[model samples]
Structure formats: C-alpha cells, structure tokens
Target: MASESTTEDHSAVKKPNGFPPLLSKKFGITDIKQDAVKWNKEWEAAIASLTAADVLKEISQKLDDSFFTPQHMELFHKSLRSLQTNVAEILSNLLNNGHFDTIWLLLNAAEQRKHILEGLKRASEDPSTIWGPDCRALCPEVTVSNFLSQSGKGFIDFLTRVAEIFGSPITPAFLPNSWWEQASNLPNPWWGQASDVSPQRQISQSTKLVFEVATITRNQFIGEWQFVLSSAFSIVSDITNRGEGMKEVLHFMENTKGHVARCLAEVKTTFRDKPIIRCENCTKTPDDIGQNVRFMVCSVCKTKLKFEVHYCSQSCQKEHWSVHKKACGKKKVTRGLSGTKGDFLWAFSDSDPVANLMRNLPKKEGRLTLRDIGVNPCNGKRSPAAERQAKMLEADKDVDYFLFTASGEPVRFVIDDLGAKMIFRINRGMIMTQPTDTTGVNAIGEYMLKLMSNYPGLSRDIIIKQLCEEYGEDIAEKIVELEQMAYSSDLLTVRCSVA
Candidate 1:
C-alpha cells in the first residue's frame, strides 16, 4: 500500500530506541545527509499519530535499554529533540482548549525526557556499567553521550514554556464563576475553582500542581535511588576536588537528603497497619478469629438494657456477666452496634480519648489577615485601637524574633507589639498571637499559657487532671474545647511527639 521509500523508512526505525539505520552506523561509516530526509518525514508523521502517553512509554523503554552506544546516543538525542518538538506543538493546541489531561500527559513526557538525560549522563560516565559488549567498542570514552547530556538547555527551555502555559491565570472567559461554584458542590471537586482569580484560589491550584509534580519526581527518585545517590556522591566528589560553588552544592545535597527522608517517612505512614480493636470479654480482636466468623452479639443487653457488647464465644459472655451485670443496667460508656467490636473499642480505647482528639486538631498553620482579627486596614475604616495595632504590625514587619518548635531549629519571626495585643509573623503568611484574657476567662487563659510555656510535653491526661482538680470537671471540658480552638487558630503551640 505504501511506496518503497516509505516502507524502507518505516522498517528502519527500531522499537524503544527509535534509531534509524542512517544514525546507527559506526564511527567513520558516513552516509549521505539527504538519505535521512524521507525517514525523518515518516518518523515525524508516525509520532504525530501516537498519543503523548505512547510517546513517553517508548522514550522510557529506550532510556531503560542496556545496548546504547555512541552511535545510538546520537540518534537518541536527535529522536528526543523531535519528540520534544512534537509534544510542544500538541501542548500548545491543548492549552487553547484547557485540556488538562493532555497537559498532564505532556508533563509526563517532559519528565521522561529528563530521565533520558540523566541516563545519558550515567552512560557517558560508565559505558561498560549499563551496556555490555554491544556498546563496549562504540562507547570506549564519553564523547557523543556527554555532549548530548550537557546540551540540556533546549529541554530546560521547553519545560519553562510548559510552566508558563500552566501558570497563566484562568479568567471568566475560560470558565465562569457560576461553573466553578457548581463544580465545587460535586463529591470530588478535583477540578477545584476554575474561574475565581483570587490569590487563595490561584495558590491552591498551583499547590496541587506542585504536589502532583513532586509525587512523580519522588516515584522516579525511588525507582533509581541507587543511581541517584551515586550521582549525588559523584557531585560531592567533584565539589571536594574543585572547592568552587561548594556552599550551593552542599545546600542542594541537604535538600536532596531531606527529600529522601520525607519519602521514606511517607511510605511508612501510608502502609502501616490500622490499630486493632480488641474484645471486652477475651481481649481478642478480629485478627484472632481463625476464619472470618462473626462474633456473637448480646441481644438481651441491646434490647432491654440499651447497651451493646461483643463476645468471641457464648461461654465467655456467660462467665463475664457477673461483672457486666452491674454496668449492664447503667448506660454503656462505649456505645455501638450489638456485634461490631471495633466501634465499641474506638469509643473506649486505653489511650486517652483526648489523645485521639489530637489527631483531629489541625497540624497546619492558620490563615491570618487584618480582617481576621477584627481590624480593617483598607480605607482607614477602623477604631483608633485597631488602627494603632495595624500600624504597629506594619512597623514591626522588619524586626526579627526567634521561635522554637519540637521538630527543628528555632525559626525567626517578626514581632508586632500593640501594647496588650501582639502578633508574630511566621512562615507561609501565618501569624501567631497570645491568648487574650476576657473578664471571666482570665484564669483559664493564664493556666493555658503557663502550661504551654512550662510544660511543652504536657500530656492530655495531665492537663485534664490538673484542670479538673483546680477548676471543676465542667471547666476541664471547657479547657479542652478552648485548647482545640486555640491550637487550630495558631494561638497556642502543641508539641507533637515524633513517631
């Protein structure tokens, strides 16, 4: 169905490598430059037909291949350039219509290109390590691969262009505010706000994109951890030899080290087994069940007593009734369905119920604004007191202060003192303030501040006990409510125990 030149050109291209016969020739074996024109045209057309995912897969496979030689290296570089061009054109077209799926695919393709570049660097440094006899003669030294790897300006430029496209603001013309509001109402608002050009919305979208990119990069780093570490070591070695730009390289090394640590921590946290909920009668959990038999439910306790309990066996329930009878008539401290063991255990775990409450408490920094603390900075529409506070914050922006956390070194902040009112500027536009003592609440505020300052490692149990002893049980409960609010509002710091 095709012409002889077309058929020859199609057949000449190899799987994964995409190298044609013209570019795969050994050193000194020159061919006419014009001969590749037909093959290039055919290759470009074939690439255009393939989806971005397919193109990336091919490139990934090629980068993973172990038979790369100097000849293949040149061809691979040329093929990568061609693929980059094709991807760029596709991305430009997709951008016009805001096709996020295709944009993600193009981003993935760009990621694969970076991987190929890294592979080329590795191949150039140690040719015999990855490739066997096929590449030994052709790549005895770093020549073509080295040049190709170093000429990464083009790839960087392409990535910059892609970022520029993604970073552009989404106006009402692209997506209406009403559409965004409707989309937000969906069960999974994965698209987020598509229209609102507010700083917060833009930041949220940008953060999501960054997180996605970080996830992909983290996966790639894990797959090639050994290679990446070795390369890092090599860079360190280079720095030691030259001693030039050592500080910058050391900083980069520290960031990489931190990144690897975070990745390992994430893996451990994600895959760790859920805590088991044990039975009240035999202290046995679902894990103890030999097969998957359901535990017996206490029907009498449920219908008459309005309380529920579980039993691994009928005999165990009968034996424990003498002790359970006293509490049977009374309301069950832990209430749940008659048979569900986990639900009961969840309500009354050995760990302080308050300790479990810590998980619900916000661990992130709180948002702050002039309006948030009852001050209007714009148009001077504020009381004299509010205006004074705002002016103090504006003046103190340049002053530096130190604050400490459990996890890391003390962070620097800038203090804005408005007499009784004060603000501490921290990272991510977050602000911290001391709790104010309202007329009747002065004692509780003083107690909380003292506890936070004196006992940074104070347990929930200890706090509750102290509060109950000094104040009443009702006051203790109120303290917990206030503490939760304070911690979430960034008014108080809670020391989180490291796992």
Candidate 2:
C-alpha cells in the first residue's frame, strides 16, 4: 500500500466513493506508462484489503505512496465536484495520449457523474456518455466539422476526434499516418464511402479486390515470347454457337516473337477480378450522355463490334457458349440444276467463302447464269450496234420481266421482303388462259376477302365496289364476265404478242 503523509494523526479520513484511487488502479482511466502500470499493480493488491473505516484520507494516503503531487490535488479539487468526476477527468487526460486499456471503467465513472449533473438540472433524464458501449458498433461516421488540411492532416483530425470523445493523450502507437491524401483521390472503384474509413484501424479492407486483379494479370502474361501468335477472335465465338472460335492457343512457351515486349505495350495492365457485366440487351442508354456506340474491332475477323458485345467483364467473355453451329448443310454438291445464286453447290476450292458462290456448280443443260436468264433488253432480231445504243435507255425504262429456265420455260418469280428472288415453277398455260391466275386484279380481290373475314365490320360488296371505283366499269365487267378464257386462242395471241 502507498504510505500516507499525516500530521501526528492516527485518525482516518473518508475514502472516495466506490473508487478509492489506489484500490481502483487496475481499472482506472489514467493510462500509466508501462513502468508506472507495473508499480501500480503491485501496490493495488496491497491497498484493496484495507477496511473502509475512513473513505477519503486512507485512499489519498495510498495514492501518495506513489508520485501523487500537490499540483494533481489542486487540479482535481478545482475542476471536479465529486470524486467520480475527478476520476473522469484523470481518465480523459490519459486518453489524450491514445491509450484505451482503462476505457471501460472510465466510461462507467463518466456516466455516473453525468447522471449527477442531470439530477441537479432536475429533468431526471439519464444523460449520455460519449463512449457508451451501445454506440460503438452502430455509428459509422464521425463528423469533425473543421478538417485540418496538411500532410497527415486527416490522421491528426481523426486523433483529435477520438480525444474529444474519450479523454486525451491517445497513444502515439495508436495513430498511423493516414494515406487519405494519396488514396482518397483514387476512385472507390466499388463506390464505398470515404468518410467511413479510419486511420487507426488494423488491416486494410482493399486487399481482396486489388490483390485478385493482380493475380489474374500475372497468370495471363507468363509466357510472352514463346510462340508465333495468330489473331484470335474471342468476342463473336464467345457470344454464340454459330460463330467460329479462337485460333489455336499459341504456345507462347515456344516464343517465336518477343511476345513479352509486345504485351508490355499496354502501360500498367490492370486486371479486374470477378467483374460483372450487365447484360448488353438490358443496359439502357445513359439519360444524360445520349446514345452513341463505342466500336471495337474483333481481333480475328476485324468485324466491328459494339461496346455492348465487347463485354464489360472478363467472366462474361469467358462463360459464353463454347461451340459453333454450321451455317450450311454439309452436302458435297448442289441439288438444283442452276448455276444461280442461292442454288446449292460444291464448296469451291480456294474460293472465298464470301464470294464465287455458285461458280463451280456442275454445268447442266437447264442450268444458267443470271445473265443468261435475264433479258438482253435487245431483241434476238437486233444487231450489236442497236443493242449497245439502247442499253442505258433499256435500264431506265420499265420492261416486262420474264422469269425463265435455261431451256426457255417461263417460271414464276416473286421478290421477297429481303429483296431476294424466290423462284416458283407454275403451268404457264394455266397462267395465260385463266382470266385471273395471277393478275393484279385477282390479288386485290383475295386481299379484300381476307380483310373482310378478319375484320367483319364493313358491309359486303366492298371489294367489288373498290375495283369498280379504281379501274372504271369497263375493266371491272371484263374481269367478272369471263367464266374462263379460251386457252388455245389466248396461247396463239400470246405467242404473237411475244413475237
């Protein structure tokens, strides 16, 4: 026990309530330096056994056995109203040096004194302690209204915030030079808040995101100069089964070219791990940015790909469908008798897949080039000089087009929506003799009938009235009166008309 200085007095003074300073040394708020802590612990056990016959004088004597000075007594008496308040002040001063060991005990004393102050105010509410245990986890940001701007200013500001709340002398070891000036300017690539971060905490939270990216890049770039690398188009092949895939994975381990040097051309390669790509089809254009596409050329085919297809994340690029589907059937030869476009044929040797489509098809009598089937726009009866002069004129004029086989059989051709010609063979004799086998008038009539059946609103005779209105009464009657046209007579007339 600390020995007391008494003036010829065997009588004891009353001890400080609940916390006699010497007995409470182990749990006191003042952060004794380690040497001071060792001495205090040795003395505390000795003081705890004393009877509380005199509360204040004995405890004060025990504290005086150590370096309890007159200055400390004067400060304690002048600043605090009670012993609890005095202990609270001592704890606050220790915390300024950044020690937290006695924080829990100090918190209790502060709360008790705060209650006394509240009682005097007579509202009878329990006042709050700044270090109340319940608050530590729930609060996220501490606002220091005035932030000092200097080198390590952020860290100093943080330290000050802690001192103001707890008590001062927050230990030097507890605060680190915060890297906020450097790191704060960097983007929170994941969009975390900057205010929630603290300079006193152990273990940086950023290792998982940053380290994983670095690992991926290192694994990818290992064999830089080993093989002759060929262009590989991963984008299209990744997106679908119908597209071609990567060329052979070049054995860069066989480094034919200086691939290391080549790859290093990208300054400071960044590897993002487990990055997520929003589905391209689901992403909306930025409301403010307006819509314009970023184009990336495919590595293999040089086909222009949109930023959407290029993939925002590596995982999306990799997890796409693995195999390609065939564009055409694998038959060795064509089925049709024409050397026409769209006719099936043998794959050309050394032919560009994009061109020379039906060039090598087996020649047969009825097979013909489009040029052969197309009208020369000059009569068989005309000479070369007349044909040359009329070429441009014929191109400009509307001519009746005949669809025919190489053998001169007339075939039916309809231009589809996509502008490709679809050929159909029909009985020319039936087409010629029938009053309306494929006449513009019959097509119009069929369309009207379908519309009426679907809609069911309009009155009957709508189609007939429309035809009468459009072509006049004479053509309408001619179309209606014919039960059938005489085939033989019409055929002869048609031949004459053709000749």
* Global lDDT of each candidate: 0.32, 0.25
Candidate 2 residue-wise lDDT, 109-185, digit = tens: 22322322222122101112111111111111211111111211222334344334323332211112132112223
Clashing pairs in 1: none
Q: Show model 1 residue runs off by greater than 4 Å.
A: 1-276, 304-307, 333-499
TM-score of 2: 0.13
Root-mean-square deviation (CA) per prediction: 26.3, 36.0
Among the numbered candidates, top lDDT falls to 1
lDDT tens readout by residue for model 1, 31-111: 224333332233334433544333222222212122222343344334433433443343343333221111112122233
What TM-score does model 1 achieve against the real structure?
0.21
Q: What's the lDDT for candidate 2?
A: 0.25
Candidate 2 residue 8 C-alpha distance from true site, Å: 64
